[model samples]
Target: MLTPQQPLGSGFGAATTTDEVMTGIDLSGKTAIVTGGYSGLGRETARVLRAAGARVIVPARDLSRAREALAGMDVEIAPMDLLDPTSIDAFAASFLESTPALHILVNSAAIMAVPELTRDARGYEYQFATNHLGHFQLTTRLLPTLRNANGARVVSVSSIGHRYSPVFLDDPHFEHRQYIPLAGYGQSKTANILFAVALDQREKAHGVRAFSLHPGAIADTGLGKYIPLEHRVAAGVIDEQGKPVRDPARQLKTIGQGAATQVWCATSQQLNSLGGVYCENVDVAPVMKEQPEKIDMADAMRLTGVVPYAIDPASADDLWELSERLLNW
Candidate 1:
């Protein structure tokens, strides 16, 4: 199994910013696909990437609203619904039709901690299917673009929730007993890290690298708006002031700060020579050996060190196969 490949003290700690980390780097002439890049940390990511000279493509589900939000921003707005496989295919096809090489792909679009068990059109559970499986299919379908890049990187935005549970290989769709939203969601998030590990191992031979990120908790960005209010309070993300405490753990980052790690992962020179680790803020997280008290322990475990589940190549391959079957890819 792959271990925490972190060089001793490799990370620059957790408070790095997109612009600060991206200093002296120029992404000129590169094409980047940032899902949900028009809102929240995604929007901030898009802004930074564009600032560094990469052409940014913000594929969003709600084009009108996304465009309105992204108005006057130097980004290309495209339509993509993660819940719809057909939409995923159409977006891929359309992009490939443009005859371009892809240098960066950030799967930052996700829904967190919802109330119920809902399924997409293909009968796949909503959270798992959209957050992990959709990106899986999208990545696979865009393999050609990824392969053609100079040195492409696929960055998946995973939360600290992977500790909720490892991949439930037995019943990924909750067919066996019950569908707990958080558990199923954890399974999907774990799959995200595994996907990066496995994909990097395979794609490094082709000059393509894959990575996963945890952007920290920023409820105001509408990142976790899908999670009901009660859950937010229960999660301790909200305070009596009806606001995020800015210190998710005594010093939490703002929305811009939350987006920093992801953008850094996507465009930082510090990571130019590395690939296939989970990062938070601007630094790659250290191995989290214990369960966190209130924050996302699962995510910390995955990012900080090599969680056994994420390092298992067989498990990742298994997940890939399961995703293929579910998506009918």
Candidate 2:
């Protein structure tokens, strides 16, 4: 059965840090793959997991930059560009050849609202292509390795930005409708959630479960580098001085805090029996059935729960089919 979108009262909150959430957990002998794990919350997560004795592999587009950022850490770096389908396939094939099992897969890489419309080789929007489609292909390719692990968890690092818009199924590539940056981003994020829901339904009986989560509004993660300073300030993520505002209550978070939920979902014993749920604040989030009336970014940030449409099972199945068709798989 699908897990309900209700908080588990895990006693962890928005202020929980990666170290805190990982307390008393030992990941020794386990293996994990974290995409975009060179920087931002992804990097922090990789660091924490490696410290906990998991063999962490980070796939990066820029090997030099990844090595520099990951220096002094024991984590391994592999070359793979999310935008390139062939690169993803190559990476998956190489990983499966060397690794017998993958205990955890964290789809932590993503791009935020790009000011301009960008498309991949397939002509899909950049945000959707990178954040959703790329991970979708990677996970499907790595399914054998994941299933090999007796129990494995797939964590999707989605965002509250999903509230900005549901997936534009009718015109996902924005061919018919005018493209808006945030809407494109929102569409991808919603896909992240729906992908988890659908994946869990199919994989849970095989001991592989999936989850999606909001990492809160972390301005230092570089995911928002494409968004302008004024817009961030307006969104209350940063101040006029260009410094990140730390307010866990309002969803703004430090890097450690922002990385907590994904880590929790990946390692928490409490979640062993649960999957296909949307989580925030280091706990399963409740469903917000009513969509707010065209709220601005600031207001959207204050919104606390997952939107109903993002977790709809029927939508999840539809998205899975659409993703397969798009990837030509």
Candidate 3:
């Protein structure tokens, strides 16, 4: 049976930090891949995993910058660009040649709220291409290595912004309708969840399970760099000067706290028997009523659970097929 999207009361809450989640859990001898691991929540994830003795591989778009960011982290940096299929394939090929097993895969790289519409190398929507399709192709390409592990886990970092829009499969690249950055971002994040659900269905019997989660609204991260400061201030998420608003209702988390959910999803032993669920705050998130009209800070926090459209089995299956056709894999 498919796991229901409901909290299991895992005793962890919104305040949990990455280090707190790693307590008493050892990842020694495991191998992990964290995309975008040079910055933001991804960097912290790589750090905690490495501290637990896991060999982490980070795929970077800028080799020099990644090397500088991860100077003493003991991670392997490989060149990759989510927008470039050839680059992705080359990186995957190189990793497969040397890696025997991949115990964890964290699809944490994403772009959010770019003011203007952008397309990738293949003429696909930039948000969808990088946030969803790129990870989809990478996970599939690395399937063999994942299956080699005893019980592999794939954690796709989705977001609360997923509520902004469902996958516009008909015009995903904004060929007909206008491209709105927030809507584009939401569609991509929703795709992340659906991808996880469908992937878990296909690979669970092979000892691989997939999960997706909202890491919470975190401050001091590169993910929000593209969002205009004025808009954030208008939303009450940040001050006029660009600092985070100190509001309990805003549900803002520290970078370490924000990384908790993804790390927990990637390495927590409690999730061994469960797969294909959307999680938040370190537990299986409950399915919430669709609240498309609510986009403010408080509503964003209140609507923390997965929406119906996101976890729909039919939608998940359809997205998988669409992805396969798009990538021709």
Candidate 4:
């Protein structure tokens, strides 16, 4: 049976940090792959997991940069670009051949609202390609190792931004509809939740559970590098100088606070039997009572519950098929 999309009241809240979630959790001998593990919440996630004794591998698009950012950390760094299919395949192939098991997979890498319209080599929108399709390809390829583990979990870092748009099944590449940065980003994030839902349904019997979450609006991370300063300032995420700022109207998260939900989703004993639900601030997010007829960026930035469109089982199943077909899997 599917887990309900409601909070378990795990006694954790928005203020919880990544380190706080790791209290008493021992991950010795576990192996984890955290994409984008060199920066932002990804870096913090890798750090805490390593502190708990898990062997973490960080796949980077730039090995030198990853090495520099990850200096002094005992973790493996490999090359893989989410935009490049050949690289993703090679990385997956190598890991499958050498690694005995993959206890955790955190699809934490993503590109947020790019100001301009961009597409991948296949003419797919850049955001959708990187955030959803790429992870889709990577996770499907890693199924064997995940299943081999005693209890494997795949954590996807979705966002409240998911409420900004539904999947544009008809024209995701902006072939017809106008290209709006937030819209593309929203569709991709929505896809992330649907992907997790469909994946958990398929893999739960094999001891693998999948989850998607909003890591909170962290202001200082490189994830917001592409967002224009004015927009961010208006969004209450930063000051004029790019420093993190807190707005009473909209809660702002520190890096540690932002990384908490994914870590909890990946390691919490409370969710051992739970999967396929979207989470926020360390708890399963409630399903929204009604989806807005139009996209509302300001409303989305503050709200918590996930829209029903994101977790619809039919849509999830259909998306899974579409993704597999797109990737030729």
**Tens digit of lDDT per residue, candidate 1, span 240-317?**
666875663432567777877777777766677578788765667665656554445223322344345654678878
Candidate 4 lDDT over residue span 214-292, tens digit each: 9888887877777778887776677778788754225478889889999999999999988999999889989998877
Q: Alpha-carbon error at 97 in model 2, in Å?
A: 0.8
Task: Return the clash pairs for model 1, or none.
Answer: 160-299, 163-298, 247-252, 248-252, 261-281, 286-304, 287-304, 287-305
Error in Å for residue 77 of model 4: 0.4
The TM-scores of all predictions, comma-separated, are: 0.90, 0.99, 0.97, 0.97
lDDT score for candidate 3 against the true structure: 0.90
lDDT of 4 at 247: 45
In order, candidate lDDTs are 0.76, 0.94, 0.90, 0.91
lDDT, residue 4, candidate 4: 96
Shift in Å, residue 94, candidate 3:
1.4
lDDT of 3 by residue, 1-329 (tens): 99978899999988888999999988998999999899999999999999999999999999999999999999999899988888889988988999989999999999998779888767899999999999999999999999999799999999999998999888889999998888999999999999999999999999999999998887578788887777667666777777875433345778888899999999998899899999998899998875666585446755568888999989999999999999987
Better of 1 and 3 by TM-score: 3
lDDT, model 2: 0.94
lDDT of 2 at 161: 89
| Model 4, position 13: C-alpha lDDT score | 88
Off by over 4 Å in 2: none
